[model samples]
Target: MPLTRVALLKGKSRAYRKAILDGVYKAMREAFDVPEGDLFMLIDEYKPSNFLYGETYLGIERDDDLVIIQITANNTRTTEKKKALYAKIVELLGEDPGIKPENIFINLVEVQKENWSFGNGIAQYG
Candidate 1:
């Protein structure tokens, strides 16, 4: 299971937002082996004044179009899978929303399977 959060500058069209979510879900499915229809994603749009980041960090040039994606998932994917997920996300977003590869930033929060509850007062994966 994975919970994803996407943060971006406000004022994007609804279609753009949908594309972002779809792109991420597709990437996770292909690279992370996420099950179908298991999406749990939230998108947060912030005003430029409220969102702050380095224009160029670690030699990566980021712009106002930058999207920060964070995912909390089971700590099971291999290094190759993680890298593939990142690349697939970039590719999908670039194809649809026209986001540059450099403008995409991703962070993974790994956790144990038993950490999830998924409702019913029970740990689904545990």
Candidate 2:
């Protein structure tokens, strides 16, 4: 299973958020060959005061778009997946929303199978 967490500075429209999610899911599916059922994506909206860039809070007086994406996966294929997914995210956002690549920050975390659970008391890969 692969878990993807995305955090963005507040103020984007709902359509923009949906575009981001759709782009991410498509990239994950293509890069990792992950089934839709094994993928999870979450979006976190933060207030201007909740995130900082240098001496200014994001989404306040600037157009700097701040995005942080974290991906956690169990397999070694995550390395390639991360690279492809990150690039795809940048491309999608840039083409769809006109967001620059420099404005995005993505993080990847690889974990063991024991670190995740699905439902009904069952682990993701168990």
Candidate 3:
């Protein structure tokens, strides 16, 4: 399972936020091959003043609606899989929240599977 963190500007409606989460989860299932019950995610909304980012980073114009998604998962996926995941996320999110692909930024942090612990103070994956 992967832990997803979605960082975006505050003030979006509940439905809108849910759409974002749903879209990401769908993408993960399709591209990352995540199991049916493995869903785990969090949304961090920040005030405009605190949510800082470049408007034209890497020559890609971004706006207030920018979304920064970071996912922490096991380092078992190949580069091709990573690319597919990114594309699927952008596509799914675009269909739902209508977020521009340019504004959808994603980062993946892969670690060993042994680092995970489902609960009970047990390193289940280990």
Candidate 4:
């Protein structure tokens, strides 16, 4: 399971935001091999003054449309799979919301499966 947090500049339309969530979830299902109904995602909007980044970090020029996505999940995926997941997220988001490739930022936080407790004080995936 993956818990995704998406941060972007405020003032986007509801459809645009939904597209981001849908694109990320679709990519996780296709590339991360996430099971159906495992969706857990959040989106946070920040004002331009509050959101800051290097406009030309690593030779990639980012614009105001930049989106920052951070995902936390079990540390069970191989390196190759992780790469695929990132690529897929960009691809899907690009196709839907038309976000520029250079504007997409993703961070993955991996943890032991036992770290998650779905409900009732039980580590469901552990």
Models 1 onward score TM values of 0.98, 0.81, 0.98, 0.98
TM-score of 4: 0.98
What is the Cα root-mean-square deviation between model 1 and the actual structure? 0.6
Worst 10 residues of 1 by lDDT: 117-126
lDDT tens digits by residue: candidate 1, 21-104: 999999999999999998999999999999999998899999999999999999998999999999999999999998999999
Candidate 2 per-residue C-alpha lDDT over 8-101 given as tens digits, one digit per residue, 9 for 90 to 100: 8888999888777777777778776778766578899899888766424454333448677777887567466668878887887787666677
Those runs of model 3 whose alpha carbons end farther than 4 Å from true positions after fitting are: none
Higher-lDDT candidate of 1 and 4: 1
Model 2, residue pairs in steric clash: none
Q: Compared with the true structure, what per-residue lDDT tens digits does model 3 show for residues 16-80?
A: 89999999999999999899989889999999889999999899999999999999999999999
Query: In candidate 4, where is summed lDDT lowest over 10 consecutive residues?
Result: 117-126
Better model by lDDT: candidate 3 vs candidate 4: 4
Task: Give each model's whole-structure lDDT.
Answer: 0.96, 0.74, 0.94, 0.95
Write model 4 residue lDDT over 6-51, tens digit each, in one string: 9999999999999999999999999998999998999999999999
TM-score of structure candidate 1: 0.98
| Clashes per model (N, Cα, C within 3 A) | 0, 0, 0, 0
Ten-residue stretch with the least lDDT total in model 3: 31-40
> Which regions of candidate 1 are displaced past 4 Å?
none
In candidate 3, which residue pairs get closer than 3 Å at backbone N, Cα or C atoms, i.e. clash? none
